[model samples]
Target: MTALPPVVDEQTWRDALADLLVREKAATKELDAIAAARRRLPAVKLPEYRLTAEDGSSVTLAEVFDGRSQLVIYHHMWSDGNRWQCSGCTGLTSQWTRTGALAELDARFVVVTNGPMDEILAYKKRVGNEMTWYSSAGSAFGADMDAGPGEGFAFNVFLRDGDDVYRTWHTTSRGAEQFSLFFAISDVLPYGRQEVWQDVPDGWPQDPTYERWLTSKDVAALYGDPEA
Candidate 1:
């Protein structure tokens, strides 16, 4: 059995929480400053590249913005002929099933994978995913952006100026975790995700990192709520 946090008097708990709140507020302020700095980061002009659309149509990188000025792409990992998809990427994509809110900010989010269009659509339907997905098949867009076929995942931001496109920022691995609500919520829990890497109290349950991630199908089966 996992050990629980030590019980304390109500007043003592409140006092401890108050102290933690101060640090939490400071962290929030620091994050705000970081975001401000990111806004000032310079972007690089990208060469013209063609990408495959959902219907197997060819589209320019600039056209991907869909008339929006800013574009966010999650470079979803894909391996040809592999029946099992990357569960981590699948879970991450699931978090953004609906992106209408981001559209209001003049930004569009989509998934770009190196897999073939037919297979991509099949998996999208099987997983009941709603976010717009595109394929980088037969294009250098994935490799130039550091998310080549069979490579790991990446999150990229782009700025579209008229017909021109520029790469603003990109991050992968742990950097993408900030966009996950699961991690944010787990951080406040008692066992704290039950992950071995976490600095938790002795006797607390801990398993291999990422072993707790739930695929879209798992969610649907467990909760009876499939996005499709």
Candidate 2:
């Protein structure tokens, strides 16, 4: 077994926790300040772009909001005609099983990919993904947003003002971690992700970063998809 944290008297443990709590509260306040600054950031109006819906129907970017004032589009990574999707993107997508609560906040969450609609739908079924997905095929929607075919993934936020749409924020890489409750929960565990990059006790287990990311096969097992 790996080494465990040293045992201490109850009062000593309580004192250690009190010290950590002080830092945790300060960090929380800093995060709140950051969010306040983010809200004050200016947004840019975007040009018109058409996207293909699940029914093969064409729709405008503004219509993606679905009558909501705010929209959050996860720019899913996809390889044209490839059945093996990006494991990282697939795992992150799987974590978003329930999004109905976001609607109460006047925000609609959906996914857009550069893959062809037909192939995307087929893959979605094979993986049992429930999130509403659209295809940017035959349009500049993906490229203009820096998430074209095979260009990686991103989370793009927008605001709708009647027929006009404004780009509010765009984040990729680790920024997308906000959507992953799995990561949030892992962070509180004793091993704390167990990744080589993280600081841990010398005897603790550690592996290369992302070495254990979930794959389509993992999702298939969870969802009971025979096709995977």
Off by over 4 Å in 1: 215-228
Compared with the true structure, model 2 gives a TM-score of: 0.97
lDDT of 1 by residue, 1-228 (tens): 648788999999999999999999999999999999999999999999999999889999999999999999999999886655787887777777668888899999999999999988877876756778899989999999999977899999999999999999999989998989888899998888988899988899989987788965674454333443
Residue pairs whose backbone atoms clash in candidate 1:
none
Residue 157 Cα positional deviation in candidate 1, in Å, after optimal superposition: 0.2
Against the reference, the lDDT scores of all candidates come to: 0.87, 0.89
Best by TM-score: 2
Which ranges of candidate 2 are over 4 A from the true structure? 224-228
Give lDDT tens digits, candidate 2, residues 54-92.
Answer: 999999999989999999999999888787688888888
TM-score of each: 0.93, 0.97
Model 1 scores a TM of 0.93
